[model samples]
Target: MKNIQFFFLVLNVLIITSCKGSGIPIDTETDINIEISTGSTVNIKIWNFRIDKDTTLLNFPKTLLGTYHFIKNKVNDFTAFNSKGEKLNIKTIGNKFVIYGSGDLNSITYNVNCSDKTSINLVSSGVIVDKDLIVLNNNILFGDFIGENRNYKVEIKKGTNFNNISNQQVYHKNDSIDIIRFRDYKQMINSPIIYSRISTNDTFFIGSTKFVLSVHSPNSMVKASLLSTILKPVTSAIINKIGFVFKDNYNLTFIYDEGLNEKVYQKIALEHPNSSVYHFFSTPSFINKRDSINYYQDLQQMVAHELFHVFTPINFRDNFDDCFYNDTLKMSPHLWLYEGFVEYYSLKILLDAGIIDKDYFFSKLAEKIYNYSKYVKMGYKISLAEASENIYDKSNLNIFYDRAAVLCFLMDIEVAELSQGKYSLYSVIKQIYKQNNKFNKDSLFFKMNSIAPGIDNFANKYIISDKYPDLSFYLSKAGLSYTMIHKEFGYYFPIKIIAYNSKTQTITIEFQENISPFVKNKQIEITEINNYKVSSYSFSFLYRRYYNQEIAFEIKYIEKGVLQSATIKPILVNVPKIPYYPNIFINRNMNFSQKRIYEKLFEK
Candidate 1:
């Protein structure tokens, strides 16, 4: 499954009053002094917390990795008492905390038991610890504001030995604090624990675009060097093609885990327009080391996919809800624009950079068309617009990627044809970005038709309905075509074999589910196929030649010390080939319209 990071506004709020018998003030506002110190590798200590009100409610993330300890005043003090002579009662439910503040509590504190499970992430989220490098954001450290929103001053003390810490507030909100600490302050030599940071950060620029690139892994210096060399040139190409300029700086963090032998990159975008964080999780198997060209190609594709979001659906959509917290995977109606079209441009930027050719682009589109045909035939008849909303069923969600890609491909061709090569999907996208229009079905429908006549009708037929329209006309517009024909694809053997003698040229069979009335199940000398001698080692070629089709077979075997033969003719099965066509390739020659469409598809 493809893992992409997305941010949404959490809309959970509850109104409740605390049960009060303690002499705590109700309407009076009081200062809450919260202090956090991580001077040792043992654990994090949050102390000296003073709350003024009796009933306090705050948001707490459920994904917090460690256990919490409620203490009074100091690090060693485990008693839960306040200064006002009233006991404190605290309860945690999901992402909210209801704290019963009393007069007896002088000060309160909590300790987080850190372990290996706390990995650092870019998003300003729950408690994350990388080695001894701790990141405490907003509510995770000193709980957020409660009741009426009011700005509070927080004093954070860091160990003298710590390095690379940031506590800058990006916004003026009371809960906008973000703190990150790097490296261990006190290393425990005698302790059996990981107590250091493998992550490092530096500034990188692509032309005027600034990026704070951070790599968190051992030997990440080499990866940083590789990315720094080409970051500028690649961004220049992508910015030009996407028709959007980055007005704000961003952060890119690459995390390489050797244990995870797969290539997975996720982008965690914040609510701020100036900041975007990407987490590139990869391993040796995913990063190509055979040469620099292949490595840069893979890296560039991944980077462009994330940067292009600055225009589409990100700036185009108004709001999105937290689906996970709601216990449902409700998606934005423009998810196709979010993922499918974003992916289309991700690959298109590669071609724009000259990293890929036109032929390669067509081949990719054709592959998607072929892959999407299966869902259409399976009666998964939800319109792309409907599927975009209720995509909780992951089984058919991936089809959205291909279906939208091919849809964009066809739409571009149609617009070019309708407008006499004057407008295309690129034109519509550029207009949206220029106007900063929020992407939606109605917006796109009107915007496309206004760009060129008949474009809206084309979208209605292809995008709003569950029908899979014929793409032969569009394929021909690009000077490409595919014919469906039944051919010997492959075969699967139902019988199980114990062993085969390659040197002696003998086969030993142990099990058979429904062996044909041909050869016996035992050690047999296989010598011929269709009366032809099998000494030339043409088994692979012969299998393909007889795949999906039945043919006469002859096997030479020694039964009871005598040579025997049997002829068995099986049934031939031919399957549908609609899902296998469109193998998109360049035509031998192009007409005027075909040449126009191709130029429009790749033009800047």
Candidate 2:
């Protein structure tokens, strides 16, 4: 997900005896009622919200990704009136419209309908309407917010046809409607409404926090229960590592793309405090599409990343840009903390859970270092602090993700060593979560330093200065090593096998060139991968589910009718002919200090 695409709303929630949202007012509540009607396709027939304050203008959802067509495609029949039931005239501005006369505008109403000429977007979200399902960004649909900081008392009038509406935070008022209260406008807008003729639901819990998984897909194989089976254990491990920041119910909306709309990029998941929505493309629509070793691994990583977001700026935030969050032009310099830290924790927690191995972890770390080098070579030589500020300038969003991961991975190690292994990055995160403090841009790092000293210096180098240090030194803290292979890169086996001969009960695979010192032949993967027998998995599953990572396997061959397995702990090496990043690996021999640090990799 693009950090820029996170032109998200921040409803600074206040907690008693806590430091969060100290200066922000969140007590005010707006009363809203929505009635949605649909036929061949989903449509918001008529919706009205009551904003008590006198207001002359209305705004559609706005975020930093640029102008959204919410006003043009999802809104119409807009009208406003006071308590007297008098009609009010409104004039269109640029992306917003103005109420002709200023009064205590108690009521505003609108309906969603795409003009015959306007194009609709389903793949990349905000607002989408499909034949079997309808997913609408509530903020994009319910346009007016009296105050950006106010909470909401929302009532969605659902007819009998709304039986398939997303099942989270629902308080049914009868057979026709459901009532729910949001802590802030941010929660209401970011929490989308999903309805599908073909849908399924699964609910899970970690601690007191409840989560409901709702799926809307044409593919019968894409079921909420199936995904829950894949996601629950990993999620439990993550939340177990870093306790759930909030004790509330959340909905995870997973929408599968059946090529019903134009394909955009890949999977897109937007995170919120209480809910998150995902758009799946290239994901296995059918569970049997991938080998047992990697069933939904791609989706697993993506969900883990999005899930970790709850701990970042959501609970731990720099409230400098509050009201400007949606369709915002303002950018925060804390993208490193917002995304970088989350990415680090996501991957680490996944590793802790065995959802991913150390080989994958080390590969990702090296890849980030390589990515940082590429950007530096391209004249994008700036610290994450600067890049985050100018994220839209040189399009350094990707750089932040790469550089930030590199920075945090190293920082986690450095932090561990600095405190004599007392506090890792997650330690700093948990302390921040407990304090419930909102950081200021200038003092964010200093505040982190107070939590775990030396953070400010780390920030000065990787975030505040244009200095990318020797990553090898940091990896060494935990008995790890890094290096690069200069070779050509090729396709990885999605099935992790090429051809299988059931008659012989044997498997065969091919490689363009041998890049690793461990594996010598061009086509020699004769036996096992990650300890799983190669013959057990399907030889041919079509879509690409896994990406650029070294595989750990063994080259087992039959010699004189005796099964012989090579000693090489293997990773397929299809290195690009061009220069690449360092590869991280576990060092078998380590000093006492290195062993202590390495043992703490999963300390908490």
Candidate 3:
């Protein structure tokens, strides 16, 4: 089973606009020359700087691959020179450099010594250089400066025999060098580059939207074709559910780490306009062991979350500044919409595609509520909008983003029920985007209300109000009952069966909570039940063989990497052992109105 615990560091992009200075030749294109050496040192040179009336602060990112890996001062020799070769005095503030005292800006040069900083084998978004490969993102390579109408180009001496790959437009200038060009600065920085000696890469199409998976891993079974096969349905689900597809090809660069770093723990998946980079924890060695996508359910969900950004706040944000984070502290107030809507759909698409059952779906939503109360217990109180604006200073709102995701889930069903299945939150969003893609963040709820009718009140109560929501109160509207069941008797099962593999004759099981106190939570195979040898009976018979038994029984499973037999004894306790998510289910008897709404909730 893939680890559900992973971090998604969101480093957004912005297009900065500055007024052009008088008589200055506004550069039509910005050219950068980069040099990469075999041992150390990654050098970058900015060719020209067309000054603007306002300040043009050149900045570099301090963090990237992971939380703690600092890429500070990787470019130590930063210096600017005018056309007359005169040195310009510059004042530094944090990571940004204020460019001042310059005639016609001639060139800026800097050599990067990446080995000097604090990566310490962490899988960060920053640059990584080693014997085998060099991974780079524009956040570390280039400086953020003025933009608009200025084309971007990069000339680099990439090295011999190293397979060069990127999401941007790449053209070869022989075996030793390559060039990449973008329409603007935003496009250029959004593209990531990977140079490796050997890799497994392939291309597949989902409804004419080409996807290329370029993988660099030491594991033999981590094939691009196999990954493409595993992720195809996930890709298709997002495309079909949203009713939109990318017209151009998109890149999925998959890179792996074998060192003693925490790369496997990072769970890194950074999104760009035309591509994304997925840094998997561990060796990515599960494909040969189990090829089913259900085995990697969290991966499936996380991939969907990243892909949904293409539609939400990413493409739909009003202006340039709204889309990009000009600084670390400045964040959009509509982050709740971005994270909540995207996360809920990640689960919805899977359920819609039958990849997961409703039991698992409701359980996940319940888990979110259970987790949020922990924060509430600690005296944390803030509305969704307030939490977003104060994300950095106060508690991180994204950490408890489920508070918002639950809101989106409620909004989704309300919209569906209100429209009598004529519309949903997803459809209304797309509909709004169809009319206008540039809706500002401040007016997001306004558009949602205009299209859905009742969302204005819904937003007022759940989003703007800091009152802790009674999820059961909302679930009741759809003919659903939410209850917290205490410890009873007799049903102490060790595994949660999510899916059955008929071909392999194995049941995909998840250990959610309290079943296995000693073992870690994961989906492992139940190879044998009692003495029946699970493969002998149908999927349903596992119940009679285990659930109804009052006596002791023996079951075999992989215990500490070995198949071992263990005896299971039933326990009946009046006291609850640990906190668990409340149970949610549809009521058998409901009023006609609620029954109709529930039917629309699960409408085919």
Candidate 4:
């Protein structure tokens, strides 16, 4: 899972950075040059400062690799050099710098600054390269400074041969490493990092954009193959659906981690228009691993969610400032449009492709509804737009996704009804992308109004206002109805089955929350439910289908080095089923117009 706390910290830093001048230009000549020969160090040269100043501050990042590591210990032997290659004087007052030299500082080199001597290390908002691979970032070579007409050139003295992110061969005319130049701090965007590996490679194009997607999953060939198969088509779908193109090579690196769910880092270059790079850290199960395929069920959805972000906040840049601190704690109110809509499409696309059935889609929707209902029941009423602005501050931040998705569900239904089955939310978004590729939130209502007359009004009520929406009305229009019931919903199993072995049809009990004192946390195996052997594939279906039934849990385990068997008759308990979302098969009957809307919803 993503470390939410760390994400918040990084968000705070970005908010501070945005408060400063973003677009100011410092006219300096000659492109910046970077030379990396070892994993533990980087050499950077600032070509020229166009303006003359008494003291220039070269800001070194205090944090390392987002918020996970600190640079205080990671960076050391920080030295500066002049145009004559002489060591210039420098002093670290605090985390920032107070430099005394004003000459043409040709270059500066520092240790890579990582405690972990792994082959691949993350540092300074980017990845570090070593003997195994070479992943580079601009932070190591360049600080946040105003430099005009400044391009960059990176030369790998040794290690692995590499290709540009665009899958184009890195042309070295006497080792050609061309760095595209841009003005302003925000425009630089952690300028694309270059990497190379010694292994043989292949190139694949995602739509018109060239991609050099490399996988370093040594443990799981299944995962590497899955990535190879899914990435291209998924990329194509996002590109075609959103109507965006890449200007330069988009580099992607997929590495295997033991227990890490896939986390993505998408870097878009303002200098190199439409150019971006992505790094995915995925946890792949080993061969013969049970539940391995089951884990991959939502993998495509995960990938789709991140890829959609490329079109929204990354490509369709957020108009508002990303401040989540006190006083100025604000963000783009269209987060619902970004996270919620992206999440909705993540599953919607899967359903459209026939990868999952309508039943599965409804189940996913129900899950989101159930989650959002918790907030509603607590009387935490906030408009979607307000929730978006204070996203990081809220304890129940996920409502940005859950509640927003529910609103989108209603909005899509509304649009279809308005167009008489001619237009849906999908079509509306495509239109918006065509008009404003990088959308401005302030102008969203204006652009959306051009597509449909009442869209702005819908936004006013559902997004901009604090009025809790009448979800039942939307459901009634969609041939469905649901009652928020308070009932006994929990069926006691005594054991929480965390990991399932698909091959053996056995579930290892991770913990036991016992209703009686008969059970405790131990190494136990649950092989059957209601006297029937259950496979990992059928676990979810059976559990939900027989949720209310009094079932027997067949168990087997080792106790004091002896195999044992027991049947656990779990005590049933009642749980709150507040703010229930209507399922796909509505209990309420549908009228002719509602029926037409329902049919159109699943139309391919």
Cα lDDT of all candidates, in order?
Answer: 0.49, 0.59, 0.62, 0.53
| Reference-based TM-score of each model | 0.60, 0.71, 0.74, 0.66
lDDT by residue (485-516, candidate 4, tens digit) is 44446554544556766446566664455533
- The parts of candidate 3 lying over 4 Å away from their true place are 1-41, 47-75, 83-85, 113-124, 259-266, 284-295, 318-329, 484-582
In candidate 3, what are the lDDT values of residues 102-174, reduced to their tens digit?
4366667776665421333323345655444556666667766634344555655555666764475567777
Tens-place lDDT digits, model 1, residues 1-604 = 0121221111111111232445442332232233233322123322233444676664433221111111111122222456554546766554445667633344444443322221333333423344334443433333333443333332233222223323123222223222322111110100011111455656766667676665555434235555656565566676677655566555555544422212222223222233333343323222112233544565666667666765665566535522122223345666667667776777887786776777676667767887777777776778887877666555545766688877777777787888888876767768765775555455767766776878878878777887777778777887777554345453433333444444454444432333466344534555444454332122232222235544455666556777678654533434542123456656769988888887777754
Residue-pair clashes per prediction, in order, are 14, 11, 8, 7
Stretches off by above 4 angstroms in model 2 are 1-55, 64-93, 104-125, 144-161, 164-167, 171-184, 260-263, 282-292, 321-329, 486-582, 602-604
Best by TM-score: 3
Q: Report model 4's TM-score to 2 decimal places.
A: 0.66
Residue 166, candidate 2: Cα error in Å is 3.7
Tell me model 3's lDDT, rounded to 2 decimals.
Answer: 0.62
Clashing pairs in 4: 26-148, 40-112, 74-113, 166-249, 172-176, 173-176, 316-438
Higher lDDT: candidate 1 or 2? Answer: 2
For TM-score, candidate 2 versus 4, the one ahead is 2
